[model samples]
Structures are given as structure tokens and as C-alpha cells.
Target: MVEFTDWDIFRNLALAARWTVLLSIIAFIGGGVVAGILLLLRMTKNVLLVGLVRVYTEVFQGTPLLMQLFLAFFGLSLLGIDIGAWTAASLAMTLFTSAYLCEIWRGCIDSLPKGQWEASRTLGLNYFQTMRYVIVPQSVRVATAPTMGFSVQVVKNTALASIIGFVELTKAGTMLNNATFEPFKVFSLVALFYFAICYPLTRYSKYLERKLNVAG
Candidate 1:
């Protein structure tokens, strides 16, 4: 068996963690864009469009993300569309993230007083104008804390990408453990790395919740 010093493992894992962070950022941003479009469509009050958005959200949110990753990685091959592990993982993560964020943002928008809509209408603002000038601005504050909290989930979820052969922190740990036969030490460090990345976001999420007085 090849020997791996603790420092060697740490160094390799830290390098791999950069990919984890990058994947999470890409997925989260892509998801936000998709979620924003869905939110706007739902806001249009078109029954068909709203129902479609609801079904999309339910389909993604109700299913296991692991299954989604598998499908993204394997299913496309059946249709003759080739994709690498990174592409598949990014696609799956973006779709999964979009579903939950859409709901979170929708709930925030709905929580606002109905009178704001009425008042905006009285001022002769159309649906788009009212949303842009009034609803969206107010809802942003309510959404910020929860959005940050969801970002932590996005980061943790990147580990699932390892199942498809993405060389992320978890995958690196697994590779190192296999090489050195040190699952305990390797995985403990892996968990510590994840905690190091996630804990600050978790704490900051709580801080925002408290500061915004939006805590449940």
C-alpha cells in the first residue's frame, strides 16, 4: 500500500475542495437564474403557466437528488447526447436547486401584505411594474437569510456529485482512503473540511434571520 502522510492528504483534499466550491457556486447561480424566471412566470397569474411551474417544482423537490444525478449522468447517453461527469452533475444540481429556491422565494413574495398589490394597482402600475417597483424590492430582505441557508445545502449537495466521478473533496477523500487504507483519518478530515466550509454560512444564516427578525 502506498503511504500518505496526513499533510499529503490534507493538501490533496484542499485542492479538491476548490472544485467543490466552484461547482456549488455554478449550480447556485444557475439555479437562481432559472428560479427567477419561474417566479416571474408564476407571478403572471396565468393558470396554465403557474400549474406548470408547480409541477416542475414538485417533480424535482419530491424526487431524490441521487436519482437525479444518476439520470443526468446516464440517461442522456441513451438519447445520444454525451456529457461528462462535471456537466451532468452541474445540470442536475442546478435543476434541484432551482426547485427549492423557487418555492422559498415564492413563499416570501406571498407573505407580503396583499394591500401592497392593491395600492400599486391604485397608482396605475401594471403587474410587471408593481412587482419590479414594490413586491420584489420588499421581498428581497425576507429572502436573503433563507437564500444563504439554502446555499449551505448547495455546498453539501456537491458531495453527491462524487458518486458520478467528479473529483471533489469527498471523492478525493475516498481516493486517499483507498490508497492509504485510512478511512477513519481520511473521512474525519473530510468531515472537518465540510464543516469548515459550511459552519460559517450556517452561523451567518442565523445571524441574518435574527437581524432581519425573520426567524421562526
Candidate 2:
């Protein structure tokens, strides 16, 4: 067993945490792009497009993220597509994040009064123009808090990527625990690291919610 000092473990875990942050950012941004596309498609109110988006959302939302990671890593290999852990993890996380975000944003948009849509039409605004000028502006205020809250989930979910050998904070903790044989110390530090990353977002989310409620 390689003896790891307390400082050595802290430094290594801190280094690995960077990958966790990077992966979460990639997943959140990629997912946001995809969800934006889906939201637009659903807004079109085309039966076929709506159905397709609904199915896509249901499939990803209903399934476990761990299973999605496994499929992304292993299923593609079975199809003779060579994909690295990073690519597979990114792909799976993006899809999973997109599904949930789509639903969250859709709910926000739907919460608007039908009169708003009618008023937009009254002003001779087309669907896209109305959405761009009116609906989206209002929905953004409603969506901001939940979006930040969801981001915390995204950060924590990066830990799941470690299952597929992504060498993130959780994986580093596991590796260090093996070397140091100190589960209590190693995992406690791991939990602390996650808390440090997530707590601010959580608190900020609550603050936003309260502020928005008061504003509303």
C-alpha cells in the first residue's frame, strides 16, 4: 500500500475536482442547447414534433442516469464505435440533462397566462417573435431559480461519471481510500468537497426563489 499523507490526499482530490467541475459545465451547457432546440420544437405545436420531443424527454427522464452512462460507454462499443470515457460520459450527461431541463423550461413557459399569448398575437407578433420578445423574457425570471437548483444536481451527478472510469473527485476519493485504507477520512473529505461546491448554489437558489416570489 502506498502511504498517502493528509496533504497528499487533499491535493489529489482537489485536482480531480477540476474534472468534475468541467464535466458538469459541459453537460449543463450542452444540455441547455439541446433543450432549447426541443423547447422550440414543442412550441411549434406540431403534433409529430411534439410527440417526438415528448418521447425523447420521457425516455431519458424515466431511466436511471447510471444506466444511461453504462449504455453510452458499453453500448456504443458493441456497435463497433470506439468512444472514450470522457466522450461517452459527456454524451450521456448531456442527454440526461437536456431531458430534465426541457421539462423544467416547458413548465415555466406553460405557466404563463393564455392572455399573454393572445396579447402577443394581438400585437401582430408571430410565434417566434412573441416568444423572443415576451414569453421568454417572463419565463426566464421564473426559470432562473430552478435552473440554479438543478445545476447543483448536475455537479453531483458528475460523480456518476466516475463509475465509468472518469477519474473525478469521487473516483479520486475511492482510489485514495484504497491506498490509505481510511474510508472515514477519505469519504468525509469527499463529502466536504461536494458540499463546498453545492452549498452556495443551494442557498442562492433559495434566495432567488424567495426574491422571485416576493417580486411576483
Candidate 3:
């Protein structure tokens, strides 16, 4: 076995962190697009769409993210579509993130006073116009913190992607450990790297909560 140095471990893990970040970004964008549509569906008075979205939200939110990844991995392959680990991980995370984000945004939109909607309509605006021009702008302030905070969860959840053969940060660390036989130091660094990525976002989430409270 080739001897591994601290720099060697750092180099490999840092390289893998790129995928972790990239996967998170793709999932963020994909989930946001899907969530936007769901938010629109949620805003409507259509009982069927609202109920459909409710079930969609419940199914994804209720299930473990790990199962989602597994299905995307082995489950899809069983159907004769041989996808890569990256594709599988991305699909799983996108669906998982979308479900949570839909609810978060729906709550933000719901929290707005009915008068905002009434006033917009009173100004000759239609439903879409009211949401786009008036309601969405205000709800953005309410949504910003939770949206960002959930991003942290999105990043952390990528760790689970390793179970589906994604060579992300966690899997890279495990590989390094097997090579160097240094589980303690290897995994400790993994934890720190995750904290380094997530801690600031968490603090900022709390900061936004306070700011919004004061604004309210």
C-alpha cells in the first residue's frame, strides 16, 4: 500500500468536496423550479391540485432520504436504465429538496395577510399579477431564512449519497481511511469539513429569524 500523507488525505477529500457542493447546487436549482410550480399550485383554490400536492409533499417528506437514493440507484437500474451514481444522487436530492421547499414557501405565502391579496386585486391585478408583483416580493423576506437554512440540510444530505456509490466527501473519507488505517483522524476531518460548510449558513439562518421578527 502506498503511504498516505496529511496533504494526500486533504487533497483527495477536498477534491471530493467539489462534487458534494456541485450536487447540492444542481439539487437546489432543480428543486427550486419544481417547488415554484408546487407553490403556484398551492396558491390556487383548486382543491384537487392542493390535495395532490399535499400527498406529494407527505410522501417525500414522510420517507427517508436514504430510501429515495436507493430507489434512484438500484431501483431505476432494475427498470433497465443504467444510470450513473451522479444522476441517481441528483435525482433523489432534487425530489427530496423540492418536497420540503414547497412546504416552506407555501407557509411563507400563507403567512401573508389576506389584505395584501385583496389590495392587489383591488388595484386591478389578477391572481398571477398579484403574486408576482406584490405577494412574492414580501414573502421573499419571510422565505429567505428558512430557504437558506434548508440549504444546509441539502448539503448535509449529500453525505447520504455516498450510500448510492457517490464518491462524495463522506465516501472519500472512508476510502482514505481504508487506505491509511486512520479512522479517527480521517472521520474527524470529515466532520469538521461538514461543519465548515454548514456552520455559517446556520448562524445566518438564526440572524434572519431575528431580523424578520424585528421587522414584524
Residue ranges of candidate 3 with Cα displaced over 4 Å: 210-215
TM-score for each model? 0.96, 0.97, 0.94
lDDT digits (tens) for residues 1-216 of candidate 1: 567888999999999999999999999999999999999988876899999999999999999999999999999987899999999999999999999999999999999999999999999999889988999988998999999999999999999999999999999999998899889999999999999999999999989989888544
- lDDT (CA) per prediction: 0.94, 0.95, 0.92
TM-score of 1: 0.96
Candidate that beats the other on lDDT, 1 or 3, i.e. the better one: 1
For model 3, residues 80-160, the per-residue Cα lDDT tens digits are 999999999999999999999999998888888999988997899998888789988989988999998999999999999
Each prediction's RMSD to truth: 1.3, 1.1, 1.5
- Report the poorest 10 consecutive residues by lDDT, candidate 3: 207-216
